[model samples]
Target: MQCDICQRSPSSRLPFNCTLCARNTLYQPRIQLAQSLLQKEALEKEVDQNVAGTPKPTRIIPAPGGKPSEPNPSWIVQRAAAEQIVSEEKTQGIHDHVKTLREEIQNTKAEIAARKARLQKRRSEFASAKQELSKSQTGAVENMDKSMRRTEHRWDILHNKTAESRLFLCREAALLYGLHQRKRKKGGLGRDVYFVGGVPIADLRDLNSMDSFDYGLRQADSSIDASPAHVTTSNTNLAHLVHLVSHYLSLRLPAEITLPHRDYPLPTILSPGSSYTGREVPFPGSTPSHSSNNSPSASRHADQRSLPRPRPLHLDKKLSALAKDDQVAYASFVEGIAFLAWDIAWLCKTQGLNVGGNSWEDVCAMGKNLWQLLLAPPPRPSVSREPSSKTPPQKPSLSRPSTAAARTLQPENPKDVPPLGHFSHGTAYGYLATASGTEYMRDWGLQHPLRVIEKVKAMLLAERTGAEWEILEGNEWEEEEAGSEAKKETKKDVVRPGIEETVILVRPGGVESGINEGSGGTEREESDGKGRGASGWMKLKSR
Candidate 1:
């Protein structure tokens, strides 16, 4: 029998078992090989069955009534399902994106509308504010214009009248000075004295300096030979020069006096609306009655309440910043002018004579000096107003013989014309040139300088008396309450008239005659009492 354990015949008989030695190696090899071959054959048979079975044609299922249909593969069904799921997800995502976009668009529209509303509101508010500002500015401009016109009118009246009277006073002073100088000199010069304008145009240096004494003497001597044209030309030139000086003086003098310092404000003349009454110049021998209830400072404040606030020229600020030397020079120059004006004013009241047409500048230029104008004899009677050659008339000349040429040069009937002392016109109007300078003087009523001075004096006196309420009405404090009873009580408070009763009267024309009357009385009393009295007017002149 063929052995199963070994492929070859068993070398050792063991009844289908290999020999013990060959059992492991040979027998085991044979058995494994046979089993492997059998398993390979079986696998091939199974594979063949599966391949051959799939060859079974795809089944065509008949539809209920018509055409046959092919069954779909499972994978294709799954793929379709997956594709559907993906498409659904994509659609959902697209929808969500579109919704978010719509929401963003709606939010943008709402934001745009809100911004536009805010911008419109702001623009309207700006326009309203701008309109209000324009209205306010226009109103302010109108008010300022009205105030300026009123102030200017007041200034014109006050300044022009004051200047006119003051000029007259100054002329009077020059005459006085001239008389005094003449008194000092024992005898009058050989030349006859005559007056032209306010100047004593004599050959003496004491009376005039512009022309040398020799030249003036020669001219007076040659009056007998001089032509009318020469005399007229000379007088015209003199008048013109005097006019120029006065014009410049008016502008400069006030500026110096009215400019504010760090410590002091402008005076009332320059600042009409200002309520600042300057340092109260007390009346002579008039001590302010001090009370236990009121201190000096308190009284001053009370007095200040009646006055306007002082306005100063802003130009002083520049001076304050200047060097010390410059400041001192400026101050001295201003003081010099003020002092000169004061001196000239003083001479007028003391002299008792008024020199018409003569101004401060005229006195300075035409006169030798203040002493000379006061002391020297009157100017030689000459051609003050020369006549034309056709109708020349003769006037006697002290210096030379009467000739036809001299007669023509001399004024016709010198005594027939009013004397300088007789003419009392204010300097501003006394000369044609000075009158030109005061174009602003039109419509201004005449006022006495002394009257204005007296008013200032009374105001000061009132202040010193601690009666501020008396000087300017409506300046005093009253206890006002809200109730009707308080009003009745306030009404019961009567105004007591005192020294200041006439103070207000002094400013207006109503009391001008009265002021003159009072002043005349005061002057007579002063003149009779102490030989030289320092009345309020005199005191102001002294200042």
Candidate 2:
């Protein structure tokens, strides 16, 4: 059998189980009650201890025999209230924290937007700047290329012009001096030589080759070994030939050549003797001879005096030496060659020689012709019969207008009339006769080198200052003619004095007075005060 409290434990229990069960059953309820009472007391004590120092107006102590104390409604309500307050405070603090977080997020978003806008603006500005920089770089490159091309073009043009000028100079020199190339007998190589009337003056090697001359010129600035021996020889020969030709032309030409270095003296090809034999003299500073009879000072003075005067168209030193020593002197020497050529052509033209066209070839041909004529041998004089006994009949002189009448009747075209101081027919014919080899030996002898030099020097001082005198004088004559023509035109427009007309004035008292006035009637009216009298009426009639 099962016990009431344990259920089915008595059969398997020990011998004293029943008595112990009865005892446990009786005191179990009391023990349980006592435990419950003790727990209540402990809880009360704990509660009292918790409120020991505080005065509690809402608390009530229960009687010992009263029903077990119920939970205090006030205390429960207080606890709930405290919990609600804590929850509400936490919710409010959370709301405030959420609001602060929201504000911070909005500020961050605005700052990000502003930064994006600034970045976009910067990107656009950078793109525009890059485009501008690219365009500027392209433009600068194109401009630099254009400048280089322009500079090259200009340099080419300048180089071409310089080459043409040099070629023209060489052509003119060849023409003036009658330079020609002749084949040598042994080597078959051509040698350049210049002649005056077929008489050879100087032998030049390879002068016709401008390249060789330029090479020599270039080499002259450097060492002597830089140039070939033939080129140097050619240059030396050309310089000597130029000296001879210049001296010969200077002696014949009326005006001086006006070369460079008139103040500073140099060496010359002219000798100190009476005749110019084309001997090379020492430098102008050196003394060639000493005289025992004279004192040192007097001898020095005599030697200085005896030194030949510097030639106008000539160089003081050789061209190669000039090139090495002074560039200006070298350039002047080249210019002097051109001047000498021009002088020769001008002389031929002045003497009525036929100078052809402006081309260098034509000028060369003309120069050659003129040189032949000038250097030709005199024609032998032929025997003539005695003078005729009968006198030649005089021709009737034609009546001509006076100088003033001729000037008044000058032609409208000024070219039809000769300028003042123009060469006369007789002088032109005399030059023609001399050039045609018809002049007497004695007359031709007057044109000898020595005599011509003296005569030309005197005539140059008196008449000519430069080679362009004739050209300047012609231009001046043209200007004067133009002025004279203008004066003639103005004179035609002028009114001349004519027959006088007599005016008779009648006064108010019937007295009559006569006045003689020419074409200046307006002047008489302005001069006389009574001419405009209001009381008198005047009548005018033409006669």
Candidate 3:
């Protein structure tokens, strides 16, 4: 047989046997070894046949004819030798398999990390949503309390018994600041102000370099002794600004003053209103009184039933945001606030409140600063306007976006429509330009600017045309519920409208001239012949 261990050699025990196979192959590890021994024995028999000690004859073994042996122990040894030759190849293959698996594991880990980031972002969004919900609830409760207080208070009784009156900024900025007040028996304005409280305009820097990051709200002491304090006439037209200031001053006032009657505007020779209450009657006193008949006692029962929430700071309240002064950044903001103030004053037809001295550009910058101050929502109190109702739920005028220019002046509402942020005086001027080129006013060849202003004012203030609300309620989903409330609550105004003075001048009827070319020296002025700019309106002198 062929030996698997020594590939080229033949086994000694094969077919029958050979003499050489008998001597040397017997030590092998298979049946062949035993067979070789038996063959050697047969040679001994041959020797016996040979008489005496004659030489033995050679024996030959031949190959078997075709069939191969079955797998036995001898075959097993052959297989083991074949397996050993292939062992290194098999080992290398196993190493490659392990390497492939490690790469796969790394890829899986990377995928898991990406998914984890997505989960974290989703969690943050959910948290913010929850916070907004809590705020809305608290706001609702506070509004309800304020509504109760205003509704139950017997305002008329307080009006008959008492009278009242109320600035920005850092004390040093008073010259550039405005003054606001609320007064009694004023038929015209609810809010009005002189210059916002400030120091000399020159002393104030154009840019607010000192960081307001460290500023904080300190609660005014709620408990104080009743005593005489500084009191002034207040106007309803400017009441919002006044309310904000009065409340702010309440925190630091050296003397406690009594509130007065309905807030009246600072007086003017010609107060523009249905009936004129001209100029404020300054109360001569070393100290102003703190007692304005409190919201009448009759009204207290209903008002006392609930915990009153604090009132929100109004337009005049000092809001400070620190941003760049350029028009692209913060100028628009200042303009919006100024516009709100000026518009309100005009609507009430109050006098002496026009924005002057400082350019509209500067006012817009101020507004931008205020936006930062509004980071957290200011407190808002709901005042009821229902006709003497003693009830569970009373309706109140929504203060947000109440004035015509309010929406125009405010920064964007998080949930409101885009492009609805505040506007500056310059923006207003652009909006009103060239509305009607053909219409002109003439009085027997003599035209007056007063007549022209009235015409333009009426046109600009006229209700919006062709705008309508659309409702989309279908299967499509959105981030928030589509709201009609936004449309209904929208208010339009410029700055604190009533506190700042405003004017509109149109040359007769449709014939109009702009403030830019009002000077007679201009060639265009001679051609238009629309007469001089606002000659005798209440705001004319202020301008």
Over 1-543, each residue of candidate 3 has an lDDT whose tens digit, in order, gives: 544444334543344344544434655556666666766675555444343333245452322333422223443455556566567678878888888888888888888887788888888887898788789878988898888777646553332222111012211121122321111123422111121221001001211211111110000122221111101111222233322332432221111121234342221111123112222332322122223335566445333332211111111321222121232223222222233333332211111111111222222222222221221112222122222222212121112323433333333333221111111122231121233211211111212123322332332223111111112223321322233233223312211324332222222222222232232121112212222221211121112
Please report how far candidate 2 places residue 380 from its true position, in Å.
Answer: 52
The segments of candidate 2 whose C-alpha lies over 4 angstroms from its true place after superposition are 1-95, 136-140, 147-151, 177-179, 185-237, 240-543
Q: What is the C-alpha RMSD of each candidate to the true structure, in Å?
A: 30.5, 37.0, 31.1
* Alpha-carbon shift of residue 137 in model 2 (angstroms): 4.5
The candidate scoring highest on TM-score is 1
- lDDT by residue (137-159, candidate 2, tens digit) is 99999999999889878865654
By TM-score rank, best first, the candidates go: 1, 2, 3
**CA lDDT of every candidate:** 0.34, 0.38, 0.28
Better structure of 2 and 3 per lDDT: 2
> For model 1, what is the error of residue 432's alpha carbon versus the real structure, in angstroms, after optimal superposition?
21
Sort order, lDDT high to low? 2, 1, 3
Distance from true location, Cα of 418 in model 1, Å: 28
Candidate 3 residues lying further than 4 Å off, grouped into runs, are: 1-237, 240-543
lDDT tens digits, residue span 1-543, model 1: 344545555454445444644554476678767766765665555444434433233333333344543434654556567667888999999999999999999999999999999889988999998899899989999999999889878765654555434444433433322211111122422332333332233221221111222233233452222222333233333223223323322322221123223333322122222212354422212343332337778666554433222222112322212213355433332232223333233222222222212333222222323323222313432223221222211222213324332232233444433222222233332232354324423222221223323333343334324321212112221221123244334422322333223211221111112322322222211111211111111111000
TM-scores for all candidates: the values are 0.27, 0.25, 0.16
